[model samples]
Target: MLSFRMLAPALIALALCGTGPASAQSFTDTQRGDIEVIVRNYLIAHPEVLEEAMNELSKRQAAAEAAKHEAAITQNADTIFNSPRGVTLGNKDGDVTFVEFFDYNCGYCKRAMTDMLDLMKSDPKLKVVLKEFPVLSQGSIEAAQVAVAARMQDASGKKYLDFHQKLLGGRGQADKARALAAAKDAGFDMARIEKDMASPEAKATIEENFKLAESMGMNGTPSYVIGKQVVVGAIGLDGLKEKISAARCGKATC
Candidate 1:
């Protein structure tokens, strides 16, 4: 009676016959059917084998995804880390650059906003870049356009960050009107923002963000590019710090 674990290797080895119709010639139909029957019965008796196999598969997939992200980060390092299109904050000359793509209308981005602020507050050596990635709706695009316009007048990112907090943290839908309200409260020159909003810069900035995000496989708000790692979603503050540590010292904690 062969155990599930014992049959696992055989199942994995049988994968060789799946390359193509020509390559599958190595295993005759009868032989393949016998192996499949044995493996299927074992898997039924011990379902943990399926779990173990899936876990291994997931590990491989994650590793492959991370490698792809690293490659994309390397290829676009200059634009991703140093492009003037993105609003730079925190230590500009820090050891690690953290780039975030967010849509103002996203609820997760609102919550993740606190985590970003906390990271900047806690880590003096962390540099932050904010890019507008408005994939949510027409209203989101409108808000992002306003945000990019606000970034134009505020080179220091003080007013822009304040404006960002207000738009993302505020209640209800984030359209041009709501964004305009937030910009006013942030004390931006309203006339200047309106003028900039209709300029090519605002449109180009958002377009560039979309291109960069698409290249890196980022399709959501609050996706982060920290130290060559493309982290999707808000993994919380501790997860962020660990990524920073890994980037800084080549480990999750340093």
Candidate 2:
């Protein structure tokens, strides 16, 4: 448990050296030691400077990370937003597109599914894309394969959404067997779904999803893309609405 007071000296040392002590050739050991003492004394006298320095450092780091995310989004825009592999929901020809990368075994994703559905129901002009990001377990991967296979059997994706709701909203771990049962409940032909599950198309779609997720630095489920902004976590329905509004009208809400 390092406190701000304890960390101030190290931060000050970095500020003076402009790099780690090992890489710093400009200052001698004696000079560096003297500078550290001076910085420590000064910071002790004026603690606000330490706070200001920390704030600036945080701002710069956030700006750099945001730039990286924006660049990644630009590079993968086509595959991310318009890929045929992604499951399409809501208005197919909507003005604003929202994308979600989710795992069936994710508890947060199950809770967030309602937010997605509610958004679809409330906003007719919003396009929703569901990416199968099954990093939780083998069962998650199996469920995603079946979901993608269900998508293939019926291109309309009507049954796919139903199957999604059934499995994600169901109790306990969602495995291949449970996923197949959901598909059956959604009126999908079990024989065809089983065959399609083992097809290369299903494998390819999941592979592409993993690739896209990796490219975008997504390491978890329930992450979202609303226009150019990459939003992580469930973030609730209000948070989603604000992002959607921001995308459409340049404001948090219309």
Candidate 3:
């Protein structure tokens, strides 16, 4: 916020004054007046720069504060999700639960899928709750509808996770047609899946997910609520493992 450009004149003035310490008795009235005039003119000419510098400083401070708040939010994920929609994975009676809010078109979500799969495979005491919070694009919404329909046909837990990973891991956009195709590839009956996707129950589930996401203040895809922590983005497998360990110990790692 302290503008180096605006400080150039002051620096030059200081350099010209030499390394000697200023003595009250050494300066003439005229010299004092000249210095004051220079400073006053410089400030007056750059009045707008002062405001700009202050605003920039304030923004940096605010961003730092927000980052701190986000870290704390990650540490306190217990109060984040009381109830969530979509299929769940891991032990039916696992000790720790990792809840995720994801969109089908989210690249980060796709990246996180590998970590989730690894966790499930390596840890038997871990549980995962997948919440469909498709807020990216219309294609994402259609994908969510198809995912909900898959859940209706008993495609919960691993199957749903599998389908989600497949759609996001690929290069194509996930629209209704593409989602249906993916559902079939994941072993779901395409016609039944499409019909179920349009049901009132599925619509209600998606609506609930939207409301929950809004209430939780989640703005983007691939946000997670693990134990008492909320992690946004794919923070990698080690990060997730640390959080899971903390959760097991009745604490949370941000």
Best candidate (score: lDDT) = 1
**Sort order, lDDT high to low:** 1, 2, 3
lDDT of 3 by residue, 10-69 (tens): 644663476455563466778766766776677678788568857887999977755764
What digit string (tens of lDDT, one per residue) describes model 2 on residues 42-145? Answer: 77799788678778989999888778878988999999999999989889999999999999999999989999999999999999999999999999999999
When summed lDDT is taken over every stretch of 10 residues in candidate 2, the lowest stretch is 1-10
**Candidate 1 wrongly placed segments (more than 4 Å):** 1-32, 41-48
Best by TM-score: 2
TM-scores of the models, in the order given:
0.87, 0.89, 0.67
Instruction: Answer with 1 or 3, whichever has the higher TM-score.
Output: 1
Per candidate, the number of residue pairs that clash is 0, 0, 6
How far residue 236's Cα lies from its native spot in candidate 1, in Å, is 1.0
Residue pairs whose backbone atoms clash in candidate 3: 74-229, 74-230, 76-228, 77-228, 77-229, 78-228
Please estimate how well model 2 matches the true structure, expressed as its whole-model Cα lDDT. Answer: 0.89
Quantify all predictions' global Cα lDDT against the true fold: 0.91, 0.89, 0.75
In the range 128-207, model 1's lDDT, one tens digit per residue, is 99999999999999999899999999899999999999899999999999999999999999999999998999999988
- The ten-residue window of minimal lDDT in model 3 covers 75-84
